[model samples]
Target chain A: MTELNELTIAEARDRLRKGDVTSVELTDACLSAIEGAGALNAFVHNTPEIAREQAAAADARIAKGDAPAMCGIPLGIKDLFCTKGVPSQAASGILEGFTPEYESTVSQKLFDAGSVMLGKLNMDEFAMGSSNETSVYGNAVNPWRRGNDETALTPGGSSGGSAAAVAADLCLAATGTDTGGSIRQPAAFTGITGIKPTYGRCSRWGIVAFASSLDQAGPMTKSVRDAAIMLEAMCGHDPKDSTSADLAVPDFEAALTGDIRGKTIGIPREYRMDGMPEEIEALWQEGIAKMRDAGAKIVDISLPHTKYALPTYYVIAPAEASSNLARYDGVRYGHRAKLEAGDGITEMYEKTRAEGFGHEVQRRVMVGTYVLSAGFYDAYYNRARKVRALIKRDFEQVFADGVDAILTPATPSAAFGLGEMKNADPVQMYLNDVFTVTVNLAGLPGISVPGGMDRQGLPLGLQLIGKPWEEGELLNCAYALEQATGFVEKPGKWW
Target chain B: MSIDTETAAKVAKLARIRVEEDALPALAQEFNTILGFIEQLNEVDVDGIEPMTSVTPMRLPRRVDEVNDGDQQAKVLSNAPDAREGFFAVPKVVE
Candidate 1:
């Protein structure tokens, strides 16, 4: 029998189907891995009894020949997603001790597909920070290393725990949500593959909203094929979410043809900005060279409005977040502060919100409120919206010119030292999202694949962006690149 | 465009967050830093450009006028910490 730690979801399903391994054994392996790697801090909550019971039921179903597509595969869900009876805190003090009675659409879909839940992984508070440091739970340590050094490095965030768990072999696969590169950035930092499907492709119904228009749930896995399988299981239309797309869901796994011959791939000239580290520039060129070797037609294109993406995203995301988070008052489903003498209902609300939200969340809310206030609305929010439209129009023109996909670096540079970014001003940190935010603003599908490592030996990721609703083609190209580059490997023991 | 401590405190109050007066200085400094970064936008020339709201230029579809969401009173009120007679209870405003 293959050791449960090394088995992929497909292999686990095959073993379960042949009656060679019971779901109980697979769940035990994952639970053991979680116990063994407790120092990694990948999981916020692990319920082995619940997982084993679910897995046993799945084993019974398979014995009765009624196995689902994701039968008995144990997966880690990011804590940002709501799971019924499980506390969905978004790793924030504000939402401490809150549990949703209903499940998020993606988590519900995974459960319906017969996947056993391993546990909820950690993330930044309200998905605010780039590094997982902002999490009420501590930062998730990276599962990679520099030679002879065992210092704990960040796995990236706000999905750091999801990426680290998968990289450390603690889970077969994990779920992540990307808003301004949350999924892809961490996946790169941890040497994993993650795809952020187009916005609205996955219903946002029970997801704790962080910038609703940009927020999208995707998969973080060991390989492109694994990501494809998980993405297929996670997508669908729901009337509950008015923004959810009403379209036919395609078999993303079936769409993976390891062929990219004659495909036109565009390299956006604007993404090759000055001040980008030389190593990343080399990796970008290396990606182009590999694609060309694989029979792809590489061409240079320009997204002239690219420089405006960060500013535009900052304005719109916070504006939407400020509105969406208004629902989280003390009286509702989250933490409520104790009332003092002479305090009325207004005081109760003020005190509760003050104690509940974190510094970053509060800062965002203030900025959002300031921009949307009556006098500043048109000057800030409205102007930012116009720039967002121009950015989309730029992509439309490029795609119209026969470019099937665009290639860019996932981030400006590889993972920096743990406290290197935390103390910097917010906009400096927001600039790290420069390359990925444009895709979100355009509502296009984007994926991050392990391209190569930097001089410091940390891994680098190359992003492939596709037009709206073309996730299948986008992932197919990613699989082809994966085969061409061959960059997938386990992180060194220092992790 | 730099914000002072008093302005920061007022902004926090308007945003429904409570910041102790002593903490207002730090908040003001942080806000000024962020505003300083946002000032980069002023450097760009956007002459004759129309402001955009969403990335996709398409307008949202409108549904016919009808009462579609009026039936979930109990479910909605279930989340209320203080509800009476099937309505959310707030402190009376008028004297």
Candidate 2:
């Protein structure tokens, strides 16, 4: 029998609807796969009991014949999302034993659509690092290897576990949040598809806030069609989240016509950074060629402020993160350090935070506080915001000039070995967000589709960025590229 | 733009994160490196450019001044490490 764990969301939905397989069987296959693949360490919390319960419920819902596309489909939830009664640590030590009393709007919506939750996936500590090594549960290993090489590679973070789990066939799809390229970069590294929908498209009500302006939730899946299918269920206007866009949710899957005739794809010259790997450059050209062959007019554009995006992102994201993270003081919830006899309220707060946060999270919090301080606010935070406006204006000008989307390499390189940059300068790890941060800075929708592989047979992805609030149109462009590239290679399972 | 140990300690104090004596030097070094990289933003001419606080331009949504939902105080305190008398208990400040 074909392993039910390997079925795409779309394929599993078809099988579920036709009574070809029960959701219980599918869920069982996934549970066993997860158990057998413990070496990957993709899931920090495994809820097999809950999985069987939700799958049974889904099977009953499917029998009623009015089920949604996600009915009976098994999926993974990133630890960043608060699933009520489940540990949602955000992979940070501070939230060590915290169980949310309420559910995140995205995960709640997925559950309401009848998707079975396999468990909570691992991620960077408070979504702070580029590699999964920062995760409190330890690194989530990528299933791909360089021709029997025993070197363990990273599934790019802060959505590392989501990427690794989906790529390793541990689940059909998973949830991921992008503050600065968390979803797209990981998807590119793992040879899967991930999309960061336009900001406010999805409600941030219960998802742990990290750079509130840039954090948007999206899907990590096996194919572009699966992303379209899962994204429709994950987005909506939530009155609870004041920033949620008050727009009607459209059928995202319907937008994928697999046709991109007459669309204009912008190739930003500023993205062509010096010392960029030859494989990455060649893969970008191949993406442009494929888009042109599919009839998208490839035009070279200039985002002059591109050089400052990483710096701007580093400042603004940390500034917002500092403010958002202040809520974790030894207070009403989360981990609290042991207070000594002389320790007062201030000591309690300080010790709790110092012990709770990891090195990277602490570094960012300090950086954020420094920039937002009285003397440096205008020079650092305010200046970065103005540069952010210029970056947004650059995209607006191109869109106004009839460009439908932009194409670039999803990551600067392919999946790097774990611990490769663990002890390197912090700035070196921050460079991983080079290509993908601009979209978050602009609050635009972007997707990473597997275009081809590097020399070691690891997958490299090409990113397509679209105008704000045009995810449907963007999905269509990605669909055209997905069809043209024909990249259906899966990572040979070593885990 | 350089952050030495004194400035790093001040920033850590403001952020309410405790840095030990040994960790302060490392923290200061990391801060200086980050600040050095972010200094590149000064090269750009952003005169007269308004700071973008949000991507979409919309006033904050207003809710009618009426109680829409509540009454689950128990559920709210379920995750609380210290809850007493329907309120979150904290270290005493007024003693």
Best by DockQ: 2
Instruction: Give the best candidate by lDDT.
Output: 2
Q: Number of clashing residue pairs in every model?
A: 4, 0
Where is the poorest 10-residue window by lDDT in model 2 chain A? A330-339
lDDT of 2 by residue, B12-91 (tens): 99999999988888889999899999999999999999999888876789999999879999988777778899998777
lDDT of 1 at B25: 93
Candidate 2 ranges with C-alpha deviation above 4 Å: none
What TM-score would you report for chain A in candidate 2?
A: 0.99
For model 2, name the residue pairs that clash: none
Compose the digit string of candidate 1's lDDT tens values, residues A335-387. Answer: 77787876777787788888888888898888887778888787778777777
Candidate 1 runs further than 4 Å off: B43-95
The numbered model that scores best in TM-score is: 2
